[model samples]
Target: MGLRPQLMDSTRSQDQDQNSTQDATALIQQLEQDRAWLLEQIDRGRWQEFRLDLAALERELGQLLQRASEHFSSGSE
Candidate 1:
């Protein structure tokens, strides 16, 4: 009985870890796509479009930084 509960808890932990890994991978892919799009816009001499993309990337980066900070702070606590 106790073993069954432990097994379920272990499985849940594994699933949570896997989900976090998938989320990180997706974020990296999104950042790469955004960077490519920004470069293309800049190469085309579309300053306005470039600015928009740059702003978006900056926002994404800022969010990621905040998330990392929060995770680390919580871990320490």
Candidate 2:
């Protein structure tokens, strides 16, 4: 017999879970890289530029954390 409906649904759900976890991880990594880049700019004594970059990074980090929280909460439900 062919695969049951429940099995197919479960497989698709697992695929979605994996993809979302990967996306969240990638976003986290990107934010970390942005932070490192900002630190490097600061080390170069670009205070003004660093300030702008830091502000932008802070906003981006907030958004990422919100997304991660939503993802985890939804996954748990």
Candidate 3:
């Protein structure tokens, strides 16, 4: 009985981790797409308009990547 509950809890934890990883991946992909779109607009002479937005997006992406790296590394341990 005790072992069964422990196994269930472990399974739940793994499910949560998988969901979190998927969410993070989706977010990163979206951010990359947004960055590419912004760059395309800039190339078409919209630099001034999207410049600040691009910078912010880059910072957010960097932070997200850093957090993900840390999270996964720690999980591996």
Candidate 4:
């Protein structure tokens, strides 16, 4: 019984980790897509709003990537 509970906990932890990884990947893809769209808008000279939005997006994307890197690396260790 004790060993079974430990196994269950380990499985749950793995599921949570997998979900987190998937969520992070999806977020990164969406952010990249948004960046591309914003860039196209900026290129067309829709300057002010899109540029600001892009800057904010870049910052968020950077932070998220850093966090994801840390999370995965820590998991490996």
Candidate 5:
């Protein structure tokens, strides 16, 4: 009986990990897109606001990666 619950818990954990991985992958794709946009903005000599937005997006991506790293590292235990 206890084993059944343990097994279920393990499965749930695996699912959560998979979900996190997917989220990370998606975020990376978004980051790439943002980077391309930033490059284009730079080439076109866009306004300062676009530059600021790019900076903010880069910081956000860094934070997200750090968060995911912490979650993955802790989850292993």
Candidate 6:
């Protein structure tokens, strides 16, 4: 026999939770590294590279927000 429906649903939910937690942790680490890189750039006066990193940071932040929203909605359900 196949897995029970409830068991499958629970497993799926757990997987989502695990993935979401990992994503959030990785995002936080990325942000910290970005912060350090920004400071280093500022000290070195690398304005051009700083601007490039800023653009990349925006993308990372957007992805983080999207993942957080998905996780929040799913967990609340």
Candidate 4 residue 12 C-alpha distance from true site, Å: 0.4
What is each predicted model's overall lDDT from 0 to 1? 0.69, 0.74, 0.74, 0.74, 0.73, 0.71
Model 1, C-alpha of 20: deviation from truth (Å): 1.6
lDDT of model 4 at residue 7?
A: 97
For 41-73, candidate 4 gives per-residue lDDT tens digits of 766777675677766776777677667767766
- The residue pairs that clash in candidate 3, if any, are none
Decoy 5 TM-score against native: 0.61
TM-score of each: 0.57, 0.58, 0.66, 0.66, 0.61, 0.52
- What are the runs in model 6 whose C-alpha is more than 4 Å off? 1-3, 47-77
lDDT of 5 by residue, 1-77 (tens): 86999999999999988898778767766766776676677567777667777667766776776676677566656
TM-score for predicted model 6 compared with the true structure = 0.52
Compose the digit string of candidate 2's lDDT tens values, residues 1-77: 46698899999999998888778777767876776776677567777746777767766776776677677668756
Please, what are the lDDT tens digits per residue for candidate 6 over residues 1-77?
A: 36698898999999998897777767767766776776567566677756767767756766875676677567656
lDDT of 1: 0.69
TM-score of 3: 0.66
In terms of lDDT, the poorest run of 10 residues in model 1 is 68-77
Question: Model 3: how large is the Cα RMSD against the reference?
Answer: 3.2
For model 6 the local lDDT of residue 53 reads: 73
Clashes of each: 0, 0, 0, 0, 0, 0
Which ranges of candidate 1 are over 4 A from the true structure?
Answer: 48-77
Q: What's the lDDT for residue 65 in model 1? A: 53
lDDT of 1 by residue, 1-77 (tens): 87999999999998987777667656766766676676677567777746777767766775775676566446444
